[model samples]
Target: MAHVKDLWWKTVKGPDGEPTQVKTARFGKGKRWLAVWHDQYGSEKSKAFKTKDPASKHANAMETDVARGEYIDPKAGDKLFGDFAKSWFNTVTVDPASEIRYESVYRLHVGPRFDKRKVKAIRPSEIQACLKELEEAFSASLAATALLVIRGVLELAEADEAIKKNPVKSKIVRQPKWQGRDVKVWSDAQISDIIGAHPAPLLPLPVIAAGCGMRQAEIFGLALEDLDFRESVIRVNRQIKKLGENYVFALPKNDKTRTVPMPANVAIVLRQHIEESPPRDYTLPWEKTDGESHTVRLLFRWPTDDQHVRARNYSETVWKPAITAAGIIPPPAADSRGRKRYETTRREGMHQLRHWYASVQLDAMVSVVALASYLGHDPKVTLSIYGHMLPSADERSRSAIDNRFEGSGLVPDGT
Candidate 1:
């Protein structure tokens, strides 16, 4: 049986034996009613409520849960959010990069607010508030990622029965609208200017990216054996990725190898690049293991060294300066003490070249399915991202409407 106890006040007696009402320690500014119950394991547990009605209600529910054998000890949820999140992180399996991203998201945004909170006590309102705060503090993508990290931890807690349900579940929290860059594709003129501004070793990078739509890492990891001049195709099987201190050869983002066709110009550029300087053996660890290593004949080599190009080093040194030189982006302004600090480049990454390729495919009237296959993207993704660039369906609709009226007298043709 469950019960609620009244937190009574003591009565003070006057000298004339008249009783004067006085508040006790239990009656002042605290929960007045105590809900007491025994768990299925015969352990006494108590919770305080501000009023008798709520206390009685909770006590009865506890008894009902115990009788139905659905009772969970509330103590199981006493673990703090930070403590539980750490354990939850260990249990989940993700790529090394994703694991690092999750940790960064947690440390930067999620940890400071809710790390001290109990898992079960976190409410949907609290989660919504946190998301709103994140929106104010970070970019839309960062805020959304932080919410996902929290939801993942709570989901693990729910699976473990630490909480009845995930508080971050449902439509309570919403991702803020992207307030960053417009989804832009560079024009052919702009592409030429940027590529022309690039120096040796970095010159072929833009041509391959715009021509084949290969990702940066995939291009960096491109091997001599993977390219076929007769077939005019590039076999994209692996990409170079940094796993901690060592670099590894990992499968492409979709985990699928594909053969991308190249134009005659792209083939010519590759031929010239290879004739000028041949591919060298760049060794990296195997993707699935740390102990074993292998070497590949990489097409692009760092100017100072014979090693394969690192994306970070190349982006900061080669790509950004080239784009700025091409007048595609303004040069970084000098700061105090005559130091120049660069803000993040605006749509100047290798992905912009990929977008240009997509625009080219769309402009050529390639079907969405075929375009998706060529780009190594899902059909829906290709449509969602680049579908707007397809030749205007509105113009076709207008032509059809004009043709319908051309032969009909129901209304004056063009009217």
Candidate 2:
């Protein structure tokens, strides 16, 4: 039960056996009213007020909150956001690469603004302001990542009862929207030229990417056993992820291991590539750089040293030169010291091959659900990213109606 007490006065028994009010010894020394309540754990909690009415209302509200199972300890939120976030991070479980990214965003963006502030002190308006500042200071993708880290920390605070609610999740706070540009797929001629420019030993790299829609990292981790020629499907099991200076084998994105159909052209190319240069046994740590070692017969490796393919090295040396030779991007310019500087953006990266593959699948009228499975993405995610590439719905509708009415008596032949 909760109630308010008048600190200045006390009820006592009078000579006539009736209750009477009397001044206490320490009357007028402090706040006149005290609101008293017990928390869910039955621990006594209290607050002082200058007057009786406000103290009574406070006590009533606390009682109501406790009855409704919404009790929040007033002093629990005094812990700083940074301290809570650090403690919360220890209980989080994510892939190593994602863990690294979350830590970076927390250190570089989230911590600077909210670290010293108490968890309960963060308001939705302040979170909105922080998001606006982040959008102005960084790319939309990076700002979105920062928002994720902030929300994660605050959600834990709410769960721990350190805060009544998460400000970041409040309705007033708006997340930064990513203004993603339409995916520009390379033309068939451009694909042909790029594939033709690769060295004979590595010619199958772009072929597999363009045909199977595998990410660059997934391609790096491709192994001989993953290819099923009889079934004509490629089992996407793992990817090569770089953790600091070392690399490890981790499951594919979102930990989804899917099978993508292998085209006849892709299978032929793989067979020929295998005949020319067989796969070699390669070993790398699993998940973490210092984790248990795993070995597989990888199809792709550096021809010179027979080592695993590092993305940066392969991009600078192999991918860039091939694209330049194919006229997709201009040749590199030489600096004063004669070092070559290639002018290219993410648009020209091997990911373009994936865009090309998606466009091809959409043009062929493949269902978005099937394509999402093949690409190892959620159906909603695939729809968002590749929806624009789908053939015009209006045209399909027109064609369907025309075909249905043409043979029916509903309309007289083109009338």
Find the candidate with the highest TM-score and give its number.
2
Model 2 TM-score on a 0 to 1 scale: 0.87
Tens digits of lDDT, candidate 1, 10-98: 57897889997777776676788888899988998889888899999999898888999778677789978998899889988877767
Candidate 1 TM-score over all chains jointly: 0.82
Candidate topping lDDT: 2
The local lDDT score (0 to 100) that residue 388 gets in candidate 1 is 70
| TM-score on alpha carbons, each prediction | 0.82, 0.87
Count the clashes in each prediction: 0, 0
Deviation of model 2 at 111, angstroms: 1.1
- Any runs in candidate 2 off by more than 4 Å, and if so which? 1-34, 50-52, 128-140, 172-181, 334-338
